[model samples]
Target: MSLFLALVLLLPSSLCHRTKAQWHTCDSGFSISATAMARNITHCRKLQTLGAELGINNYSTTPNSSTSIDVVFSALPPTPQGWIAWGVNPGRHPQMVGTRALIAFNQPSGMPVVNTYNVTADTRRGCKLEPSTIEVGVANKAANYSDETGRLTMAARLTLPPEYNVSKLNHVWQVGPRVVGTVPLAHAKTLHNFDSKETMDLESGVGHSQRHHDIGLREAHGILSVIGWGTLLPIGVIVSRYFRGSPIDTKNKWFYAHVGIQILAFSLGVAAWGIGLSLMERSGQYRAFMGHRIVGILIFCLATLQVMALWLKPKMLDKYRKYWNIYHHFVGYSLIVLIIVNIFKGYAILKPAPRWKWAYIGILIGLSCVALGLEISIWFVFLKPDDKKAQTNASDPSKTSNPN
Candidate 1:
């Protein structure tokens, strides 16, 4: 169950989990330094034009530039009581104000594409924001900048972010607005041009590392199944013969090793599985890669059933008894075949036969299948037949027995 839980957490986290540091959050209303604000202007410059392409607004600011930029914050009309604000929200999480900043983008369709920030601020520019300070408002939020054009206004929104401080000479701006990142129909061409031509080489390099990790990890996962369900069980049974009824009840060394190895293999496979899943998400191959998850669930069920069967009735000697052997063989062999078949399914999804993936899977499958066929044929034709004839002759020698 612990292993299962670990696996469950790995999937979604691997797929969609974002780095919190990149999007640090506090209670409510945050601030960012003026220097960090300058970087957005440079990044956003290339992402201007019409229609939506792609955009990004990173909060992690760059330092050392002694420049200030213009900043404007929209605020609620001054109340009769004047501007008011509080840090700890009503029974909700408190926000770290004066340390976070707002970052807005122009993404074409809310996809994760590298673009520039449409909204920015800096100290040297001496930018001024409307209702600049964290204060009481209609939304009870701070520093909200939005693109007024689209039905779904924002391409990305960072809330309760960290780093809300802004310092410029005498003006130290402590403002936290709902960081709004937008992909306006206004900046489509520029974004597309940079995303298509300028970004191809850089992004390809990043994409390569992610894709390679996925393909390798996924392919290795199949090997885990072969080792656990296929090879381990038989090895355990063979070992058990030597210690059929020993002090340690060493019925099968192979079985012991099989179980232990399987548990460990599952652990290792889990690591690989997680890496593959994360890579898939980063590469945007999640749709085609969903089948891998289904296969994992099935493998979990098979492993669970086998474990439960043994735990529920740990009959050491009875395991080798005639009736028990029949049940054991049936269940054990079924699991092996199921795992093997699912491995083939994984190969189909991850590989393109005769291609990189196909060759790897082909080698494993071809060998396992041929071995299984030979083993079965040899058992039925030679081993089992001889045993059966010996039994028949022994029975004939006792002809005096009553038919009833």
Candidate 2:
């Protein structure tokens, strides 16, 4: 009987040891240290951004009891002087504004240190992110930087409040380029940095990133806006200004072309504007983008007025024709300027790839070159003949004499 009982006890210990060894290897192709291995992490997830990975152990919660769990976070810093951070936001709507972050950085003495910070609204408004005690209880917090692999690993035992739900926890992670003193400077304002927040199921290790939800819609909005306001509308203006008396204006084709292009541009612009409204409704960042939204609305109103004025245009012989022309030219040029400004604002808000911004800049440069060449050619066409006539009269005064 004593030998049989000892065999049963030894069997469970051997199985547990085998399980621990299996989990010590992360799916991200890195191995945790022996200390983190001892945490007995049962679940691990490779995060979607920043080449991050998370591991959790003892993820248990009970009613009216504070939940305690061991967590391990790992990521490679963008630079040796950079820092890495991981956190949870317990707010009803999870975002970076209220995250309880554990930020890890190398001290001036080359020691890895982990500190907790409570990210607040002020932090978003240019306030410095200073280390502070967070609402979530963090114990046994430790960090290590590996020079060989260029990765930072942080481990902490978190004591979440009873009200904090582990099933749908919102987690955020980031890596910044440089650290000043002990504070981590801001990360890059790229799409990847903006998309680091996600909702995770601690028990099953299932999670979905915010990037997957809205990236398609955002791309659609940006493309349409660029084609309509940034490209087509400007082309339409060019046709009206330069094509009117050019060789291509045969049969008044320039007028028809301008109208057609404007109509198409307006249609696309209105669609993009509607999409922008829908996106604003779905997002919680209204305050951050308030200026962009306001400018978009103004552009829509002015463009609509321009389109409607097409029908109210005065005849070329009418006494009011000059006044109408003034209004038309003023409003059209104003719309073009506003469109360009707001397109740049959208770029800032979207924070797309650098190549995208440079592409738009190249397009603007191309358009400006075209406009400048057309202006110089028009001046030569109109002024050169007058100069010739004046020279002929100066040489032979009879050409300027009145027959009467």
Candidate 3:
């Protein structure tokens, strides 16, 4: 029994140590031996979204030549039964459709197999992905899965088509959960899965993620819109409402402040609107954001009218001054409401980090608190005395009597 206990303890430790060593080896670098005619890999890149690595050995006569290359892709599957894939899209856009891929998975008999697939739009619709010839010439294909490290590595030598450029190659990589027989089941529709494509320069190993670039633009647009329409516009309204007639109106400085703030806010809003248009053109996701785009256009038109109304202001003693005031107040308040609603809509569309959404919520709450306090103070300071004077006058019969 003592011997048995010792053996059990040693067995777990040995297995753990071996597993750790294997993981380190796999994560550190690709160790598959190069082909007999292969040159040393000049470039290797860690993909941004998926936890995958790619190593490339370019055999082109020139940097821009469309020659052959050897590539190795390594990644850990989402599950032990899952599969891994790496591919190139010859199209101008880097996406899953129209990709030539090499997919690797293990069979029930524990044998690793790699197959070429020509991914079409139908493949995205859950069609069975079968082994087929691709546009590019493929040879020297091999794949292996390491049980200890849980890593799948696929190596291939590809001959490029005449039109292919070695400097700008669109590549994609993915990991799936399971395979039904030889066919890979659908991968989870997560953000990481959608963001598994990028453009790479095989010669220099430089990669640029299109998703990251788009995200950066979106963040800029969100920030500008929040500051201009959501935050500053409300503050301008508050200043015009409360400070214009208050004791702080020396030299009518409140008017200038309101004007300056509104103009600045409008400028930023216009910039944000322009950026939104650019993003729509680039992404072509207009239908998804139709409501948002319409609301944004409405806000822009109303804001432009408000700015123009500044120049068309009536004189203080003009007969139509009250009508102008009514229009201004109505439009201003309506804009505030629409701005808040559209900001929330943008938050839903962007789906940025949680902290950003919460931060905007906190800003709105703080602004509401300030507005509520000011409203109560205004009622007490201005409206209460007038009400009390009218009551006093009504109580006194002499003061209430009209001069006939």
User: How would you encode candidate 3's per-residue C-alpha lDDT over 200-237 as one tens digit per residue?
Assistant: 77666666665755665666678779988999899899
Candidate 1, residues 160-262, lDDT tens digits: the string is 2123222211111111212224222211111112111111111111111122234344444444444444444434433343334434555555456656655
The CA lDDT at 340 in model 3 is: 88
- Sequence-dependent TM-score of model 1: 0.36
How many clashing pairs per prediction, in order? 48, 0, 0
Q: Can you give the lDDT of residue 287 in candidate 2?
A: 58
Model 3 stretches with alpha carbons more than 4 Å out: 1-44, 56-70, 74-85, 91-98, 102-132, 139-157, 174-196, 208-216, 250-253, 283-295, 311-331, 344-355, 390-404
Clashing pairs in 3: none
Candidate 1 global CA lDDT score = 0.36
Give Cα-based local distance difference scores for all models: 0.36, 0.80, 0.78
> By lDDT, who's the top model here?
2
TM-score of each: 0.36, 0.71, 0.66
The candidate, 1 or 3, that scores higher on TM-score is 3
The number of residue pairs in model 3 that clash at the backbone is 0
Candidate 1 ranges with C-alpha deviation above 4 Å: 1-209, 212-251, 280-287, 308-310, 314-331, 352-404
Task: List all candidate RMSDs to the true structure.
Answer: 16.1, 13.7, 13.9
